[model samples]
Target chain A: MHHRLDALLPLAGAILFVMLWWLLALSGVIDPVLMPAPQDAAVALWKGFADGTLTHDFWQTVWRTVLSFVIATAIGVPLGIALGSSSRVYAAVEFVIDFFRSTPASALFPMFLVIFGVGEKTKIAVAAFGAALVILFNVAYGVMNAKKTRQAAAHVMGAGRLRIMVDVTLWESLPQTFVGMRSGISLALVIVIVAEMFIGSTDGLGQRVINAQMVFDMPLMYAAIFAAGALGYGLNLLFLVIERRFVHWGGK
Target chain B: MTSHSPGSPHITIRGLTKAFAGVPLYDGFNLDFARGRITSIFGPNGCGKSTLINMIAGLMPMDGGQVLFDGKTLRETVIGYVFQNYRDALFPWKRAIDNIAYPLVRAGMDRAAIDARVDELVTSFDIGFDLKRYPYELSGGQQQLVSIMRALAPRPEVLFLDEPFSALDYEMTLSMRDKLQEVFHATGVTMILVSHDLEEAVYLADHVLMLTRRPTRIAEVIDFGAPRPRTSATLSEPGFVRAKAHALDVFQREVRRAP
Candidate 1:
């Protein structure tokens, strides 16, 4: 009985939250323009889906996020492994990595815009840069912290440098690499949306939000925001599932 | 059985010197390990027994002198080292069978050959546990068994076990010792064991090399001429008792001499 109730708790809380919002809207204490009714937002969500505007914009944002994320992983994972494997390489580049990792990724947007000319490239570059740093940091630490005994065991078995890297270091760093990928993808989405909102974008969920707010379409604006949040949650859930399946021995 | 005279040294160590954090552990140390025999190294806590075996196994570097193998350089000779921490020694991600087959896989053995070798070993050891489980899923003794199986997979010329049974419980330790003896007899591999337990050293080894503390040296090398397939009864045999006592005497004298 308790298990069943526990499973329903999240749904119950969501229902209560929506009911409170509806009651507050009915009370007329707050402006409807600022806090639209839940039903009105639902209606706007349906209209956008029926007209296909929401679907197109959603796919556009997803494509940009995925493209930048792939680029980040491609550059960051190998670089991280190299730095982690060699203390000399890590020492040479440590200061630079720390400096860029600490600096807010948004601060680099002006430079990216100048180089890429405010096109899709600039938007993708900013997101990829941020995501790469996160992945690199995690991968390097993972390689550095691999258990010493395992390495020694492999060495005694006559494993050469390349074999050790592929069989031991790569598998050892996998759990942490997954962690980096999850956070990297999330940051990629955030940067893409921010770019769409502030920088010039022809069509995206963020563009729809900006356009709706300018025309005082509060319900449409709220619906677009909800869709973006749903996308993030869904992406995070996808990563969690993959991590569980692949990294079953992570905690062990 | 192979002849094990002082003249027939399979591995000869000369003037080995090593220090940790500027404190000397082995200063100009020297010894010879015979082929086809189980040699146990015994010393007090913090002694350099593990260090000595690691250096010989070429797992670590020696500051001075060199190790001369009978027929090859250190790199060309196949070696196996089983660490004290079996939990960390075995790869937790791989299943027990995979761990056993890791060395063969590294040697680029074909799939059928690898499977055949692994199956042969499993049949020889006669360990009835499921080999499909991950290392972490098995008990401590089972994991260490997998580690030993992996070490033997490469058919190493010399197998260095750094206190392999130190972490196991009494029952597990007994069973693991039995398994080690069976494998040792079957393969006749040159075995070097670093041990702290006096009785265990005598029970498992054909000869025991007792050492002094830091700045370590071989205080004495006592040989046990007991029969093969040592068992619980061997622990109480007169030969075993005499060898253990001789090792204990040397160990106490050396430890007491330290300032």
Candidate 2:
């Protein structure tokens, strides 16, 4: 009973907040154009669904985010592993990674637009760059903290460097890698949406929100904002499930 | 069985020296393990027993020395080592059976053969209660036994054990000793054990190597010519008692001399 209640607490809080917003709107304390009532937001979301506008934008956002995440994992995981395993390489690249991390992803948006132009490619580049920075450091930290004795034991057991990585280093760092990917997913979602919103785009959820705001369609804009939040929460839960399945030892 | 193979010693160490932070641990250390015999190293705490074993295991680099195995450099030889801390010895994430099969995975054995060997070892070691259980779930004694089986599964020429039974209770330790004797008798592999417990050392070793304190060097090498199939009766033998007394004296002297 207690566990179920704990799980439901967040949903309960969200419902209460929506109800409070409805009451505030009903009292005429805020104008409809400025603060849409909960029902108006829901109606606007439902109308978008019927017209296929919401579905198209949602799929566009999903594809771009997924592609960006894959690109980040492909480049970031290997670079992180290499830097982590070799002391000389890590020392050489440490300053560069730190600088990239400190520079905001938004600052690179204009550069990406100039180089790649305002398209899916530009948005992906921005998202991948931002997401890769987060995962690379995590991978380095995981490799540095790997057990020496385990590696030595594998060596004595006739494992070469590659085998040592498969049996020991990579396997041991797997949990940390999963954690890094989890965090990267969240960061990528944030950057991908922002990239889609600011950089020229016409079909993504971010573009829809910007379009609504420009036309003074407050209900549509609020609905899109809520949709983005929902999508982020859903992706986080999905990543958590993946983490649990792969690393059963690390309990939820 | 009385003499080593008609060649150089199975393992030969000469002028082995190791230092940490300007403090010398082993200086001009020399030792050898004869082929097909169990040798135990006994010493007072901080006498570099672990340091010597770690060097032999190739876990650490020696300050100045050479280690020869069967007249070959250590880089050219195969060795198996069992750490005293079972917590460190076994990977907590792996199941007991997989842990036992680790050596085979490293050796590039076929999956079927590895599975067969792992099954045999699991049965031989009686690790059935929780073959699928992780190391952290098992007791200290259970984990230690699993560690020993993991080290032995590879069937290395020379096995290095660093006080693997120290953490066990009295009864568990005795049973583990019995299991070890059974394994050694069955395999006939050379063994070297490093320990501080005199009785435990004499109980298991054919020859006990004693060491002095830091800047450590061998104090003495006591040979127990007791016949094989060692048991409780071996401990009561006159020579065993005398050797234990002598080991105690060296241990006490080292204790007094160490800062």
Candidate 3:
């Protein structure tokens, strides 16, 4: 009984949240133009899906997010390994990495706009840049914290520098690398959506939200925002499944 | 293989000196490990036995001494070190078989040869457990067995075991001791083991080097001339008891004299 209650707790909380939102809308506590009723938003979601606009926007956002994530992973993994393996390399780049990591990628939109010239490339590049820094930081620390005994064992077994890096260092850092990848992908999706909403984009879930708000289509705006939230949650769940499969011995 | 006499030195440590934070551990220390024998170094806690073996293994550089292999240079010689913490020593991600195959893989052996070698070791040891399971899934004793197997994988001329069985339960320790004795007899590899347990030191070793505390030197070198393949029954034998008592006597004397 307790286990069943524990399992249903999240669902109960979600229902309660929705109930509170509906009550506020029905009571006229907030402007209906700003916060549409739950039923109106549900209708708008169904209509958008039927018209294929929601599907196109969803796929576009997903494509940009995946592309940026891949780019970030490709660059971040190797750089992180190198930096983590060598103290000299880490010291050389630590300050620069820290500076970029602390500076919000959104704040650099104007600079990105000028450099990549207001296109999909600019938005993708900015998201990829942010994702890369996150992954690189995680990967470096993972490498740095690779067990000393394992490395020594490899060394004593007559493994050379490069061989040890591949055999010992790389596998040791894998659990941490997965952590970085998951967070990196999430950040990539967030940056891509923000970029779509702010930077010039013709189609995306973000753009739909903006377009609906401009036309005072409150239900459509709320539906698009809900779609974005679902997308983030879905992507995060996907990464979690992958992590569980690949890094089974992570905490053990 | 060039056969040296039973008492001939395999590794010689000359004029060794080591210090930690201005306190001397080994000052002008010298020792010789015999060829093709199991030598156990037993001392009190924090006596630098592990440090000494680490230096000899070339895992840690000596402060001023040279550890010279009798006929081969350090690089030319293959060494295997089984760490005390088997959990950290064995790669958790790799399966038992893969961990055993690691040193062979490092030696650039072909896949077929590596598999054959691992299979031979597993068969010779008569290991009954599943080799496909990852290290974490194995029991503590099994994990240490995997560690020992990895060390033996390279067919190392010298195997350094730093308190290999200290983490095991009483039953597991006894079983591992028998397993270790079997390996030693089969391979005749020169084994240097460091232990905190005096009985374990006397049982596993053909020769026991008992050390004093810091500024450590060999307080006694007691030889257990008992038979090979020492069993649990051997632990009660007259020679084993005598050897253990002598080691304890030397250790007590050394501790009493420490300033």
> CA lDDT of each candidate?
0.89, 0.82, 0.90
Q: Which stretches of candidate 2 lie over 4 Å from their true place?
A: A1-7, A250-252, B1-9, B91-94, B130-140, B166-174, B196-199, B223-245
lDDT of 1 by residue, A1-252 (tens): 999899999899889988999999889899999889999998999899889998898999999999999999999999999999998889899999989988888889999988999789999999999999999989998998888888889888878888888878888998999999999999999998888888899888888899899999999998999889999999999999999899888857
Q: Write the per-residue lDDT of candidate 1 for residues B154-211, one digit (tens) a residue.
A: 8988889999999999999999999999899898888999998888898999888988
Candidate 2 lDDT for residue A89? 88
TM-score of each: 0.94, 0.88, 0.94
Q: What is the DockQ of candidate 1?
A: 0.66
**Candidates ranked by TM-score:** 3, 1, 2
Better of 1 and 2 by TM-score: 1
TM-score of chain A as modeled in candidate 2: 0.93
Q: Which one wins by lDDT: 2 or 3? A: 3
Clashing pairs in 3: none
CAPRI tier for the interface of model 2: acceptable
Ranking by DockQ: 3, 1, 2
- C-alpha RMSD of candidate 3: 2.2
Chain B TM-score against the true chain B, candidate 3: 0.96
lDDT of 2 by residue, B1-259 (tens): 2335632378889998888999888778788777877889877777778778888888888999889877777767767888887786687678877888888886789999998888787777665468688877888888888888888887788899988888888898888888888888888788899876789898888888887778787777888777777888988999889988887887787778846
Candidate 2 chain B TM? 0.91
